[model samples]
Target: MNQSPLVIGARSIDVGYFNVKFTLGRPASHGGPAPVGNFPAIAPVLRSGAARHMEGVAQPDGCVVPINGVTYFVGPGAAQRGSGTDARLVKEDYATSDRYLALLRGALWRIAGDAGDAGDAKDVVIRRLGLGLPLNTYFDAAQALRDRAVGEHVVGAGANERRVTVEQARVIVQPQGTIIHFGYTNGGKPLEGVTMVVDPGGGTLDWYLSERTTPYWERSGAYPKAMLACAYAVADRLDPGWRDQPAIVDRIDRAIREQRSSFTVQGQEIQMAEHRPAVEQVLDESIDQMLTAVGKMDDVDHLLFTGGGASVFSARLQKRYPRLKKITRMDVDPIYSNVRGFQVVAEADLASAKGW
Candidate 1:
């Protein structure tokens, strides 16, 4: 008789400026609510009883979706809800925000369900979760994000109007999840010499040098110009005044990330392909800075690239620096590399506990 593969559920989750990625023992999935339009602190309306009822009521507060008595609005949906009067379109303090927490918990519950064999809703249980943060985040800050994430439980709507409870969840971090992934993909090979890890995320572009597989912390830093900036660059081309229009900004962000051929402008659809040059230009500007930094790192034998931003612009990056072919280059699906790496780390831990 043939043996079946073990059906264990271990997932790595990455919440970035562009999207929320979840990589399981199986394939990866990137879907969660993002902010609906360009409105500050407002997320798109998530479908709920109250929101459904007020669909056509011209909701000033946007459509509110309450979870555990805390209201929220998910991304890429109808209606919208603002975080606060002074909320931003993309918050740097996302890890601790109630709305963000609601989103994270909701995503985790869905990922768990995707793992299958989901238990009944009556019993609250603890689950192991893996998380990743940008390279620039200090150890203390990353720990803070992890600390806040663990032991977190939330009650919210799940598939088919079912209620989901995730309790006492534990979260761990291996900064940039991509590093873990690189190690696994290389057949657990020990990295030697100078290796440059470039992780360009939604909100930041970060890189570091590693010697013999250990990161040289002193050489690593982060830049704010990243995927979001690329979207902004595209928006600047479509309309010089687009910043004032939140919905337009939202559309541009979705269009660029989703690779939509066109985006709406003032109720009119415009071809995004026409502005491709502008997008590439903005991305090139960011990557150039990263390359400049790498050049100062003496002699690098390997270059590892991961992150949605990197995935989005890798082809262009490679094209610009054909010399990239000279190095021991590794470029996986930038979106899930980090999360998948995290999953691998979690699995190793699980295996060790079972003495495997």
Candidate 2:
């Protein structure tokens, strides 16, 4: 009798427009939390000639990945050393773009490296891979996204290269991951009645309405006005030229997240207090649009918030719905909620497949 290949485990990668979150499921022996992390969703392409020179430099915050003959420096510091072009992908077709693949591969490379599996011939094989698509695109693009994800991928370059095989992939509406995560963390108790999840991300404000876990497709959708909208509005007021610079937008986002009244730009300190009204105005408009889409909330038993912008919109959401509950805790960072839920779902599916 032939022996079957050992199933290492499952992993999830939540690739958002502004950031990429991932989770490597916890080991059986460990009773603690799973290993989870995230990096900015910036993948700067490098020409073959330039990539060769990068081999000698040390990248503490990011890595260089080669996929399909193209090279990209992905993660935090990548934008600074990358070519002068904007590396952030905000287009609707981003799920199928080269930059998206590069970020996904780069994240796998990082996970393998951190787990001490880099350069191993045996490879790090994830039995199941969980991913998410924005509400607006989930219907039309989820299948394509899953197809791209479920396969063998070689990440990194030369000596740093590592093989990662995704045996299966599961794609869900981005915000749905939060509810799944919420239930998993709360002792597997099923959510009662109707639940609405409002996920404010960088590029979109995605909402999902469901009774328990079954979705109400008609009431859920995404709005393009989200964090970037505030960033752009603030940028336009600060300097119209800054609107095109993702780095500037990133800085503004950080400031907004930190609740800082000022930020630095090209060695000069810029006051952000003047831009508060603009940010509030845009956020208010986004909240109105979200409310309009979800219609009456009287039937909603639980109103939850998640995603990178969860905290940013928490106040407005709480004020609007006094019963609003944030899908976050002291240990759970809202940004990683989706990927964590992905891991939970993957592990459960794997268990069920084996009749465990």
Candidate 3:
């Protein structure tokens, strides 16, 4: 068994489909590591055997990273990599793979590094960790993920060989994380009525209803392909050939994230801003799909939106579902809201456990 760190409490992490955001416990002690990116797949920077954290354009000293023999750019500066037919989006099943775990370690590395910047002399240790799993993930799968995340040691050989340890951990369903977030932020606002949470993330669109009094979630649904539809639609408008090239598709997706007006396609410029209509059209379709799956959530008093991708289309969402009496707006970055909620939940759990 791995030894626990010399920390007083648990730290929380939210591993989203698009990003990994985490918060340190008693940040005043560990130094604050603001939410870090889950930038995928490390690439070896040329000539040094050192891997770059995220995508960027090739510098005079840079080269591309390969995954399964496919070369692509990751993280920042990705736009400079130019377009390729083999570029790929790096996503994995959090419940079944190490991708999310690696990202979690990445978050820890940032925390420790930040602590160093803050003049702290000890490495960061999380006595407990709260992890978020996608809604509708099976119980067994979530348990497996929780088991893997807790007490699991990860050494980021490419990421400065940074390490993080969790003495205890618990998994919160992703949608429920949003609910806890809304409830905690609302403060005494009765969560008694029906409330719906729609988390449109990079990989999945998760929706669930909670009847605030019962401590249970209802009618939870996961729409796996909804978030990608907009990117696909925008790509279709830009280049019919993009679908055939994972790299080009990824670039288009990145362009969407950067809110860029254009992206390169085999040395040609494809205007993205002009494709807003396509994006809106696809977004409408996605909403329609969600509405169909969610059916009519009658008497939904609270409609909270929290996810990395939620803010951009939240206005549209609010307009589309105007019947919701109170639309909760997140005061913090929507991407970190779920994790913040997870932290809140973990603290509550610890409090109950410790009789504090």
Candidate 4:
């Protein structure tokens, strides 16, 4: 397919979404050193929230780092109908989809405030969405956008759809490991020189060294490594009511961001600090168990750690062997690591095929 392909780093809403990646430099990789001038000619893609980080470092030369990518806001337009087995139930899922879109608009307004007509009310029907909102503000906002979307004088308004197809993940799946690998990316062969991969994100974590480096985008599985789960699970077990309190998420989030063992929680009424030794012991035991399940050996690992959860778990991973040699950060937010690597692999393959 002669397509102008896309390589996207994720947005904020996608904190736990799939295809996030990890990047590791060769040995002797140093940060904040003078630019080495040997970085492979690759593009960085960001959308929604994550774009701001890339803007701060686009090279001082003003060379316009040549951003060739798309910014997709994957809310609202999620397909309202269930295809294949449940086509007949489309009407059943309509309300669910509408409620979801309403919530998505609420989030959008949260991101892009009342700037103009896109942010205006009155044009759209502000109805009750049944959310436990403090007020029906989003209902008012969504109605405006919905009206503007379908209204007259607005060219291709409805065409700017946000829905996703059931098959939207084709590129995110690995061809192999299908029947056995639940939610595995349907596979395509890896490009040469593509052996290592690290995929990090919220919700789950995953990594692998392929027997052969397939295009990273072509390799997919349920990213089961969750940086948040462990800590929150710890928090939950420690306090059953923790989930009900937003303070716990905030505290854990702070601990993760600062890379500190401690942070404030329980509305600052309590402090949550990791017993690193105990946490790592439990963590290591779990990783070892997962290693067995994924059919990997402890020695001779070519692994990469990529995901939003990478930083959070990396603390415990510090005591393990070859920490300097094997561990890598594909980017600041490890969640975007895999998809970006996958983009590089695909681009490299394309270049090779053309004998460039």
lDDT of each: 0.56, 0.77, 0.59, 0.31
lDDT preference between candidates 1 and 4, better one:
1
Which parts of model 3 are misplaced by more than 4 Å?
1-5, 26-94, 115-124, 138-140, 152-154, 157-159, 188-192, 213-218, 240-274, 318-332
- Model 1 gets an lDDT of 0.56
Model 4, which residues run further than 4 Å from truth? 1-194, 215-225, 266-271, 274-278, 294-302, 323-333, 338-356
- Give the per-residue lDDT of model 2 (tens digit) for 210-314: 998899989899988789888888888868777667788889988887788899998999888888889888888888888888888778877677777777887
State TM-scores per candidate.
0.70, 0.89, 0.72, 0.42
Q: Clashes in model 1: which pairs?
A: 33-75, 34-75, 36-44, 38-246, 177-338
True-structure Cα RMSD, model 1: 7.7
1-356: candidate 1 lDDT, tens digit per residue: 02331233345566665555665344333222111111222344343444443555754422233655555654333224432221224445666566655555545544534444553232233234567665555454566666666653444334322233332223433334566666666667646687777777667777867776577676666666776677778877765566545556667777876788987665788888788888888787777776666556447777777665555666676788677657635465565666676666665665566688
Which portions of model 1 show Cα errors greater than 4 Å? 1-9, 26-50, 53-69, 75-91, 115-127, 157-175, 190-192, 240-285, 288-295, 311-322, 328-330, 354-356
Residue range with the least summed lDDT across 10 consecutive positions in model 2: 324-333
The top-ranked prediction according to TM-score is 2
Ranking by TM-score: 2, 3, 1, 4
